[model samples]
Target: MKEKHEIGALILRVVLGLIFIGHGTQKFQGGIENIAGWFDSIGLPGFLAYIVASLEVVGGIALILGLATRVVGGLFVLLLLGAIIKVQLAVGFIGGYAYDLALLTISLFLLMNGSKLYSLDKLLFKAKNN
Candidate 1:
């Protein structure tokens, strides 16, 4: 049923949001410069790493609060796509690529569907209607 699907999607959104927020928190603990340094060490553009880290942190918050869920999800999909192409694909599915792939799929789904019932988005919609 539609209700069941909505509940499942909400659970997925919360879990994914928490995981992203946790990783972002690690980055913030040492600040964006630290993350940028790590990216530079890997031969990546340091500024871009900061951008990705910011997106993960702020986007995770957006998702957790169900605010602008589609926009955040879409941004995350782009972020994950970059990760998959830049890092995971060459390494193959051996070292946790499966998990990343699953997350990417879920993010894409969220982008398409947006937050469901009981979310801030849903409440906003209802408030506007009423």
Candidate 2:
């Protein structure tokens, strides 16, 4: 049973990480200045574009590696929530929010549970039965 849960976590982490990496790479390909321009058009600080892009890229890697899962997940949840409030909500659930909502839920789950079996966190910080 525990192994099953661990496997589930691994699946979720990998899928979510891949999605983030794709999106992050897209942002980079589109150019940070262009992203910042879009952010400005949307009434957010232009500098946030770089910050968000960096978070997605680096956090995605951390998630895939199962390093600091809780921290990365929490950050991703916040990022997705911001996207929901600032953009996706206006598009409505069917149009945009469905995907964001799903990602947000998964991120929340990871944030609460952290990584399980095949995680660097586990290997690096294993408890000793002293």
Candidate 3:
């Protein structure tokens, strides 16, 4: 049971990390400009869109390596919260809330649990246990 839990957590971590990275990559590639323009169209400050994009990209990379997992996860949680508020809240549950919910849940989990075995944090912290 313990092993299964660990495996499940690790899987969630990896998948979530990958998704974050992809989001970040899209922003890094200038997709955020388009997104920002959209935000502007919708009465939001275009700059905020870029800020969210940058945070997503940076936080995503950190999550992927399990480096500063708690911090990154927390940041992601904030980002997702903003996303939910700015976009999903009015769009209804089926529109964009689902993905944000998933990401937010996983990020909160990571913030609470941190990384697992085979993570940079594990490697760095392991010596203190022995």
Candidate 4:
């Protein structure tokens, strides 16, 4: 296997997508209403639960497909930041912000790098470096 950053980006994109997909699916499986109530308890609007869940699932799919990579990355960054600030910060690094920070870093990478090669941006948009 060649050690190409494109391949690495692809792997990162897919894995991140899978993680978000699983989380989003879990939210639905556990009941959107319950998630909504939890969101309200956390000082966020209950409707946000549906939006977040939808973003996670839809954005994850978009990531895997290499579509709108930068856009999806930006959304992920915002979501992670919100999670860290609104909830995970209280739990401390061991079980909270650490993982979120990692995800945020990856999101930042995707935002900055724009999925590198092997992406829709490159294929369809004819992005020079993406």
Each model's TM-score, in the order given? 0.88, 0.95, 0.84, 0.91
Candidate 2 per-residue lDDT over residues 1-130, each given as its tens digit: 8888889999999889899988888999989899999999999999999899989988988888898999999999999999999999999999889999999999999999876667788777778312
Mind giving the per-residue lDDT tens digits that candidate 4 earns over 7-81?
Answer: 888888988989999899999999999999999999999999999999999999999989998899999999999
lDDT of each: 0.82, 0.90, 0.80, 0.89
Name the better of 1 and 2 by TM-score.
2
Ten contiguous residues minimizing lDDT sum, candidate 1: 121-130
Total clashes, candidate 3?
0
Which parts of model 4 have CA positions greater than 4 angstroms off? 1-3, 127-130
Candidate ordering by lDDT (highest first): 2, 4, 1, 3
Better of 2 and 4 by lDDT: 2
Residues 66-128 of candidate 3: C-alpha lDDT, one tens digit per residue: 678888888889888988997798888886699799889999998898766567777777886
- Which sections of candidate 3 miss by over 4 Å? 128-130
Model 1, position 61: C-alpha lDDT score: 81
lDDT of 3: 0.80
